[model samples]
Target chain A: MNLRFQATKARTSSLVLVSPALVLLGLLFFYPILLLFFTTLEGENIGNYAQVVNSGTSMQVFLNTLRIAAIVTVVDLVLAYPLAIYISRLSPAGKAIALFLVLIPLWTSQLVRTYAWMVLLGRQGPINNMLIWLGVIDAPIRLANSEFAVVAGMTHILLPYMLLPIYNSVSKIDNSLFDAARGLGAGAFSTFTRVLVPLSIQGVLAGVSLVLVLSLGVFIMPALLGGGRVPVIALLIEQQAGSFLNWAMAGTLSAILMVIVMITFLIIKFATRMFVRGRIDVAST
Target chain B: MPDLRNTSALKLESIRKTFGRVDALTSINLEVNAGEFLTILGPSGSGKTTLLRLIAGFVTPDSGRLAIFGKDMTMASAGKREIGMVFQHYALFPHLTVLENVMFPLEMRKHSRRDAADKASAALAAVRLDAFGDRYPKQLSGGQQQRVALARAVVFEPKLLLLDEPFSALDRRLRESMQREVKQLQASLNLTTIFITHDQEEALVMSDRIAVIDRGTIQQLGTPNEIYYHPRSITVAQFIGESNILEGTETPEGLRTSSGMLLRRASPSTSGRVLVRPEAIRITREPATGGATNQFKGKIASRTFVGGFTIYQVDVYGGDTLTVRCLADEGSMFEASQEVNLSIREADCRPVPQDAKDAGA
Candidate 1:
């Protein structure tokens, strides 16, 4: 009986210690989400949700958002994996310099970085001028204000997110394992594929999930670089709220985006759990 | 007909390796016969691990010729050298099951999956870990993990095996048992193995022949008995066991210490150190009555009972304080400040030449 009472007293004290942060979160985060939900029901009916779910254009925008996020994720991973591996193999001073370069862009405002990409990809920019000089093209082409421009800008902006996690995971592996693999008759290629890749998979998954989720809800880079040529869910929601002044419709779109984010998170979590469980099963059997 | 049974498994001719400013291994010339278990014994940073890495092809010597089975392998990569290595930390792949870890080398050599699994099972059975083939390395105890490492190393049947202090993490009893198991397994497979360790007792218990290393050089190489009883240098004598080193000059009669104590020993050198093991000196309360060879009268400065033997630091009259060990069942125990007579025969005192350069100074 005394032990149970002691355990209850410990639990009550911990709850009291954490109550301040919990109250702050309730007011700042949860209250706004609750307000957003009630505003979506402004007409005292589910008409706004029904309109978004039934509209072909809104559904097309949703699919476009997923496609763009996927493309961005693939591009980020292809560029990040090898770069992270290279940075991990550098000396201490070299690693510091390399990581500093990777993080320098994050210090600048995202809007400013997007405008920089706009200048590079403009029709009369250096990229097009160089193409003309090399005789690869007769005239400057439409490089900016397209889906390709959005992807390029987003990839440049979000690369460090993909690189840092994988680098951390790869650097934490025991180096003796590589020597052990090589001493056991594995050549360089086999050793890397069998040892390095499987051990650093956790980092790969973390980077991929972070990049994918961030890309899905991105707004500024796509809105500026795409110049109305491309439309993602965030851009559509902004148009509904700012241009049309349709608060209920905007709230409904935001709710849908929030649901998609939650689903994306669940899918990634489920996939990772399944992957780890599968490995455990293979080991046990 | 030439004898085929005497082929050398490995030969290192004048192997010398150096880091940027450090000499890791200097002028190492050694050979191992087929199926021989040779241990490189040294203190830390003594270049024993460097020598093993050189043999395993992880280190390229600055100058030398390394041959395995009479074939030169000086420029070969680690994977092409056909040497199995067990790291001090066991280094079992954390993601791989015990059976899969053993099967890795076989798979790398292009064996079929079924064949690799079968051979891995057999190897696991050899180490008596067949029942644990499904467990990951982290799930096993330290001893079990070491056994898995041993099984994985030998499964591929490499020409030479190198073990880098494989049992330093286990408890004393478990270390002894693992030592016996590894020795038996090596013998049964007839594997030419080179084991490295800093523990002198482990080296003596496990190695067929030991190479005592000091500061990038092999100080002595011989059987355990020769190393224990007849160390040629003062460095080897002091490192291998507890001893009372009496520094003196050799006269026509015997060795005469600076403090006027004469010890009986035949020596070719003008001046050297004589090693008398603590247990070799006979300590008694009565004085010598017969042919007194090298006898001294001393008072016990301190007594330490170490279960098997009682150690006494005896301050001899006008000479060095010598450590003497007496067995527990010696019928009498001397207390502190008790006068005792210590006697040692001439054969028990081995003269060790002073090395030209002190190692690891």
Candidate 2:
């Protein structure tokens, strides 16, 4: 009985130690989510969800969000994979410099980065002028305020998120595995495709998951670079709450996006588990 | 490349390698016969590993020629060299199963899928891991992983096999069994094998001929018996086994040790150290009657029972301690401070050069 009382006292002291952070999180984080959920149910319960799901424009916006996110994720992966590999193979000082370059844009303000892209991708920007000077284009084409602009901006902003995880994974591979592959009669290209690619799948998956989710929920990049031509779920949700003053529709859209994000997270988690199973979970003998 | 079955499997001519300011290998000239099991043995930081990498075509020699099966391959890339190597950590692909790993070399050679599977399974069976072909590398124990690595390396039957301290990570019992298994496999396949290791006993047991390396050069290269019984220098003697070297001058009768014991042996050198292995010295409470030529008196300083043999550290009257090993079952036990006599045959007292460079200097 004395031991049990001591255990209770220990538990109580630990709870007291953590209570302040717990209360802060409840007030600032979870409480807002709870209020959002209740706002979706105000005066209409299932009606708001039904209306959002049934509307053709809302459905089209949702599909557009998925398509744009998929494109951005793919573009970021293609750009990040080779760069990550190159950086991971560098010396310590070289790796530091390369990583610093990759992270500079990520550390800058997102609003500033988007606006910078606007200037660069303008009608008479350097890209169009250079194309005209090189005789590739007859005139300055529309570079900004299009689907291409949105994809380009998001890929630039979200690239470091994809590259860092893949770099970490690729760098942890043993150097001797490369030697062994070549010694076993694998040419340079064959060794890379068979050995390096298979071993670094985990990192690729991690980068894909991060870029995909972030691209789906992105709002500002599409609003500015897309010039309201590309309608996405996030942009539509923002308009519902800010311009239309329709709190119910905004809350319901947010809840649907949150559920989709959580589901995507679970699917990626399951895929990661499947890929890394029996490969990395064994004891390091 | 010519398939010269009778030619030397590997030949090195004045090979040297330097990493920036450090000479990793220097003036290495060696030849390996076909189907010969040669081991490069040394302490850590010796040039044995550098030599192996050079032969395997991983590192280019700064100056020298390397030939495998009569083909000068000094500038060849590793993949074109047709050499198979097993790393110390096995280097098995973690994402590939045992079967897939073994099939890798065959697949690289462009074998059909059915043929690769057949050969891969046969290779797995050779390593006694046929039942575990589907399991990944991480799913296997260290010894099993080593077997998988071995299977993968030899699946395509390359021109030469290089093993870089592959058994260093196993437990003692597992290491012994794996050594025997590897040796037997090499013999059966008639594979020309070059093993690199810092382990003396492992080299002695596994290699038909051993090269002892020190300070970026070969100190001595000979058969295991020759290396043990007739070390050319003090460095080789002390590195291979436990030694009690007595530095002294040569006398008409024998060598007079600096420690004041006149060891009865005709010296090969005027003044040098003579090595007497611990097992070569016999200890008894009383000297034997016949053929007790190099007998000396000493008091037992300590005794250690090491399973079948007991090692006694005897403090000789000449003020130097000589380690003596005797069969534990054959003789009476000697306690500390007990008086004893130690005898060594004249053949056992080998005159050795004092330094590694002295052998050729």
Candidate 3:
């Protein structure tokens, strides 16, 4: 009875410790997801799901989402890995400054930042004006409302999400591991591949997973920058719910997106499991 | 290329390393002969590890040359140095299996995966861990992990093996036994090794010669007997082992102690120090005991019995302390506070340049 009472006390405090995050996830995330799935089953709108998938515009939007997400995730990983590695070499003060600058974009709303790209990449924006002045081009280059602009805007917002986790993971690595690799007859390239990259894979998985998942739901960047050219699932869902008053179709599309996000996450989770377990086995023996 | 295992012939010429403003190693020079176990003996913060790093090529010397078999490798990468090293923490990869860890060097040599695995298995067997080939480093005992480290280092048959206090993490008994095992292995393989240690007794047991380092400089480098019995510095005497010391004063015959005792003659500098070996000092309880060069009297200050021996500290005049070793079988006839006479041969009481402390400890 005494042991059970102690166990109950421990459980209660642990629950209390995580209560705020649990409440937020339940209210803002889980409840909305449940509501979305429930609304898709409403009796009158069964054919609405078929309408979106069958539409030429909706099919294009769906493919665009996968394409853009892949491109952005790859870019994020490539750009972030080098930056994270460079940051790992910095002193504490230097690292703090770099991270502060990297995360500064996160302090602002994504919508406002994407709109700022409007002023910069617009027809008469400084970039085109400079090009015209240099006689590089006779006319204002069409920079805004393109797939390239949308990718740029989304990558700008999501880069920190990729870099910070990788940076944290790289920093925790035992610096002596590098020295050990060198001592074991490994050159610079071999050491980086065998030791640095493999050790920091956990960070890569996390950063890429989060960025890929977040990119799936990015509607504002495509809407503002793609100029109706870069259709994506998020934009289709928005149109179905708002202008079409077809909430059921919207819910169905949301469910499909949710399934994809979960599957991607599960793949990532499995990979991370392999890594953590591999580490544990190595440690015990 | 000549075999590194068969010969020593290592030189660190004017090696220097600076971490910012702090000098980790400064103009350090050392040479070890072939087929010898030379221990770089120093206290922590004495740049001993840094010196190892420079030789291993993990850290480039700011200004110096590291030569193995008299071949200049100062600008060479760590892989190019081809020296085997055992880290203090063992630094075994926590992700790879034991065999995989051992196979890493072969893989670096561009050996096929199958060949690397075969070599790794052989290396594990050499460490007497054949059954543990599939296990990871963490699963092994501390002693076993040390063995795996040893096998991994020598698996490639590199000639210059460097050990950075590899046994410091093991228990005392395990350390001594491992020392014997490593010494036999080195002798059998004829591997030239530069071992670093802070323990004087360990150095005495292992190295053919010892370089006693202090404050980033070599105070003295010689055979264990030469360094112990004929230390040129006060620091060497204290660092090497325990000592009984008295201030030195010049005498007509040679150097004298504070007690007006004339000790044996030794090379004298204008400013000199005297050193002596404890084994050189003779202690006897019988009053008629004579024939030794010098004699003194004291009560047993303390007596502690080791399993095979009894160590007696005799408190002599002028507050000098003398340690007397009596074999277990010989039996200690004196108890604490018992009056005893101590005698040492004049030859054994050879004065150091000064009484760096005492003639005999």
Candidate 4:
């Protein structure tokens, strides 16, 4: 009886200790979101949401955002997987060097990295100069302010996110499994597809979801590389808040993007839960 | 590639492997007979696992010739060699069900799904795991997982099966049962198997022939009895079981011990050490007479009860300390500090060459 009372008292004290952080988070983060939601509903009522949905330019911008995010996620996956595998198989010194290369870009500011791509993709940049010097083209080509430029920039920025997780999972795998698979009469391709790829699926899922969600909310890459040609949801929200001073429309757009991000989070969580469950079927034999 | 000879299932000629500067295996020449259970026994870092990996095609020898079933497989890839291996850790695919793991080899060979499933089920049943086909590897016990690995390896009926200390992870009772199960499985299938282990008792219990390996080479390769009773060197005798080694010079009758006691030998040799098994020596209160050619007086220094036997450490009157194992008969107990005579048959003492001793050191 005394133990039960002490346990309850301990639980109450733990809760009291954690309540300050909870209250701080609620006040600093969630309270602002609640205020933003209310501001969207003020005066305009449902018309702001209707405007976000019905505006053809807004619709195209939303679709273009999804398209660019999807392309960036795919391009990052394709580029990161082989590089992650290569890094996972390297010698100790080689692995250190490879991981250093993957991480050095991340230490730089995201804006600076995006602008560096701008310098490289410009008509007067070294790429165009090289093309002309090689006689591949008679004139410097227009490479900046394009969707391709935005994707290239974003893929470069998000690649380490994809590569690190995949590298972690790949490195965790026992090399003996590869030997066992090959010893079981599996060719190199068969061993990789049947054994290595399936085992690393969780890492792939984590990386893809991270890249996808981050891509959806991307602002700087599109702003700097797209140069207003590739306006996405974040840019639309920026225009409503900054140039137009339409706070209601901006809040409504912000609420929609938040909902989309939340839905993506839910889908990814559900998919990961399913995949993990499938991987470990703990049944009594 | 030349055709393999019918008599030998696997052959290794002058196999040498070096890792940067360290020699993992050197001058490893051996031939495994068809359907024979050959065990490579050694302590850790003794090149047993290296030899096994070489046979499995996981590690290529720096210089050697390897042939399987009359075909030269020196440069063949692991998949092309048609060899099966059960790794020390089992190495079952965590994401795959037991049935799928067993069916992997068949699937790789392009068998139809239905056919592969049927064969995999048969293999699982053989390992007594038919009902657990749908379960993942983590669901099974260590012994069950090992059996699953064994089933996966043998499902394709490869030319050779290599087991790399597969039972080292299990507890004592489970290890013994799994050893028996694997030996029985190997016999029933008539499969050629090369098993690697550091456990001497397991090698004696499971192998048709045992190769005692150390320092990147095979020290001795023979039948279990040959390895135990007639070890080629003092190192082999010491590694395989308990032995008391008496260093001495050769005399007319036998070996002259450093302490001046003469130990009789069936065939006299110039100079070497004599290895005497502890159990081979007989201890008595008075000097033992007749048929036994060598006798010494000693006082018991200590006694240890080891379940079935009482090991007595006897300090001989001359200089050497001899360990004598006596069967645990309560009535025949010898107390510490009691003087006793130790008698050993002349033929039982083995003379180990000085060069082999130096090589072992």
Candidate 5:
């Protein structure tokens, strides 16, 4: 009886310690998601959803946002992998320097970073001024308030996020593993492809998922750097809620966007779980 | 490429490895024969693992040459060297099943996957693990993981096998059993093996020749019997087995003890110190029955009774202690502070080896 009482006491204390974080998470994050889903069901008769779903403008905005997110994610990975390798190979002092450099952009507000991109990418920015100076063009190139400008800003904000997780993962890989592979006759490319890349899949998935999910909800970058012409799903929701004052329609479109985002996340999560945990030859063997 | 299995031997000539400022190996030199089981025995931080890693091509030496079969292989890559390594942790890929781990080298050697799988099955069967091919390394016990590591290392048929304290993690029984298994397998396959271990018993039991290493250098190399009975240095005698080394003084009327006892010279004791194995000393009840060259009067200080043998610590005068290995079945009369006569023949003791001076220096 005393043993049973002690066991219960231990479990009760463990649950108590975990309860505060769980409560905060449920209220702050999970509650809003639940409410968002409930509002989708609350509006009278699929009428609000039908209006948002049938709108061609909403469809175009969704595609445009998706295209930007996909392109940015791919480009970000290409730039981040080498930088991650550089950081992972650095000495302790060099590592400190690399970490400071990576985190420096994160210190300021993300919106301010996007505005910095605006100064660099504007019509008379350094790129055009350089081109004019070099006699490559007669006039300054029209650069700002375009899709390119929004992509530039989004990439800048999200590049460090992708680099850090990958750097941490790559750094933890036992260097002897690469030596072992090479000793066993694996060429450089094969070693990287088979061993290094597979081992670092957790970081790849983390960086990809973080960048994709974060870019989907991006508002200020598109609103400020991107002219009002290049409309995104966030812009559409703003139009519906602020201008049309159609809260129900905004909620329905948000539900659709949330579904799309969840589908992408499900694919990534399922693939990552299989990539890391699934026996590489579960069925074939 | 060098023929690693050719009848000659592996020689590391003045091999030196330094990382930036720290010297890991300094002017190291050694030779391992084609099929001989040579163990690099050392305590931790003695650079034995670094030496193995250098030969395995995991790290390139900063200077000097490594020759296998008369071909200089100092700068050769690991794939070209074909040295198989068994890690202390076994290092079986956690994600791979037992059979897949064995087949990895075969696949790396460009064998067809189907053929590799068949050979892997045979290798696993050799280690008596055929029935466990479906289990991952983590699912197996420590002994099982060690066998899988063995199977993985041997499946490729590498000419040289390097084991870095492979059995340091097993229980005593398991270690003994695995040591027997590894010795039998190595003899059957005729593969040259270099085992690195700090455990003296494991080295004595498993190695045909044990190389005692200390502070990044080989102190002595000899057979187990030779190392135990005829040790070169005090360190080797102490490291390999129990012994009693007395610091002698050359005085009038022969080599005498600190407490005015006369002992006959053994093998020209010009060197100030002499080493003697504990078992070589003969303890008898009668004082002058035999014409023993050396004799001393002492009292048993302590008796530790192990099952097979009892070790007696005798306090000899002039502040020197002597250890005696008595057989459990000796039926010898002995007790604490019991006055006894200790005698050793002139043939059993000698001046410590020259390497002992370097070790001391």
Candidate 6:
């Protein structure tokens, strides 16, 4: 009885300690979201949602957002996994330097980095000048103001998020497992594909979902690097609210994007839980 | 199964390894006979694990020739060498079931799925874990997980087996039982095995021949009885079991102890240390009136009861302390500070050379 009473007392104290943060979250985050939902429903009916979904241009924008996000996520995974593996195997000093290099771009403002990409991919830039000087092309190629440039910029920015989680998972693997696998007659590639990859899948899934979700809502990279060639949901919402002065349409689009992101998060959570439940139980021993 | 034509399972010629400035293995040359159990016994940082890793092909020696079954494997990768190893942590695949873990080697060898499952089941049955095929490794006890590892190691029938302190995590009773199980399994399969551990008792109990190692070198390699009864140097004598070492100089008659006591022995040797096993020293309250050659009058300073035997610390007349082991059921017990007579035969006093370089080499 005394133990239960002390447990309830501790719980109450913890609740009191967290109440201030809860109130701030309620006022700043939840309140704005509630107001946005109400505003979307105020001057709009259910037809607004249908119009946004059925309109060919708006539908193309949503599909383009999904396609760009998927492309960037795949490219990030392919580049980041090998880099994370390399970093995880380095000496302490080398590891520190590698991690610093991966994280340095994250410290810079995204707009600044996107603008830097603009300079690199512009006409008469170093790449085109070098290509023209090498006589590989008759004229300077158009590199900027395209979907490829936007993907390249976003991939460069979001790579560290993918790298760190995979590094964490790979480094946590016991070194002896590799030796044991080899001792059991497994070759180098067999050990990696059969043992190392499966063990680090949790981190791979996490990095993939994080990059995918973040890429879906990317604003600055498409805005600056795409040069009005790329049309995404976030850019469309900005145009609807600021340029067109259509508040209901902007609110409806924002709500749809928010719903897509939430669904992505829920799907990732469900997939991760199902994938790791058995392995985690075995690893705990 | 091991190759029958090759008499030696493994041969190490001048195997030497150095880490930074410290010599991990100074110079090691050993031959493991086919179908024999050899244990490398030592304290921590004694190069026992280093030697095992070298044999398993995980470590490349600085300068040496390693042969398995008369085939030179000095430059071979670990996967190319047909060997099985049980790690100190069991190293079971946490993502796989018990049956899948045992079938891993067979699958790697490109066996059919049905064949792999059948062999895995048979291997698990050998370790008496047949009922736990579907359970994951985390669901098993430490001992059970280790048994699963053992099954996985032997499922593919590697030429040799390496065990690196496989039972150090279990309780005493569990460790003993597992030791017996492994020994029986090894003998039944006639497998050439190399086990490494720091526990002297476990080495003596399980190994056919125990190699006592210290400071990256083998101090003595012999049977358990030879190691316990006849050690080569002071280091081996002190490491293998409890003993009383008396430093003395050789004389024309026998040995003259540093404490000014002249002890008579069968052989007259030079200045060295003598190792007297504690159990060999007979203790009595009355003075000896028999034909015993070596006798000393002492006072019991302390007594420690270790279940079956009582170890008494005796202070001799010349200020040298000696330990005497008496059985617990010896009818009478001597109290502290009681005068006692300790006697030993001349054959029981073995001479050990005092090597100054062997202290921490």
Docking quality (DockQ) for each candidate: 0.53, 0.56, 0.56, 0.71, 0.38, 0.67
**Top-scoring candidate (DockQ):** 4
Give lDDT tens digits, candidate 2, residues A146-214.
999999999999999999989998999999999999888899899889998778888898899999999
Q: Compute each candidate's TM-score over C-alphas.
A: 0.90, 0.86, 0.87, 0.94, 0.87, 0.92
Fnat per candidate, as a fraction, reads: 0.72, 0.85, 0.74, 0.92, 0.34, 0.83
Q: Which 10 consecutive positions of candidate 4 chain B have the poorest summed lDDT?
A: B352-361
Kindly give the number of clashing pairs for every candidate.
Answer: 0, 0, 20, 3, 0, 0
Q: Cα miss at B136, model 1 (Å)?
A: 1.9
Which is the winner by DockQ between candidate 1 and candidate 2? 2
Docking level of model 3: medium
* Model 2: residue A53 alpha-carbon error in angstroms: 6.6
User: Higher-TM-score candidate among 4 and 6?
Assistant: 4
Of candidate 1 chain B, the 10-residue stretch with the lowest lDDT total is B1-10
Residue pair clashes in candidate 5:
none
lDDT: worst 10-residue window of model 2 chain B: B352-361
Tens digit of lDDT per residue, candidate 1, span B1-361?
Answer: 1222237899888899999899998899888889999999999999998998889888899998888888788889998888888999999988788999999999999999999999999999999999998888888899999999998899999999899999999999999999999999999999999999999999888888999998898999999999999887888888998998888787877888877789987453444578899999999889877684689999999999898999999999898999998887656899899999999888888888777467446
Model 4 bad stretches (over 4 Å): A1-14, A91-97, A132-135, A280-285, B1-4, B355-361
Name the DockQ score for candidate 1.
Answer: 0.53
Tens-place lDDT digits, model 2, residues B1-361:
3443339999888888999999898788888899999999998888888888888888899998888888889999998888888999999988888899999999999999899999999999999999999888888899999999998889899889899999999999999999999999999999999999999999999999999998888888899999998888788988998999888888777777777888776456544578899999988889856674688888999999999999999999975799888889745799999999888888888888667565443
Better of 2 and 5 by TM-score: 5
**Over the stretch A76-182, how does candidate 4's per-residue lDDT look in tens digits?**
99999999988999999999999999999999999899889999999999999999999999998978898889999999999999999999999999999998888
Summarize candidate 6's per-residue lDDT along B277-350 as a digit string, tens digits. Answer: 99998998787777846888999999998889999999999848999897986579899999999888888888
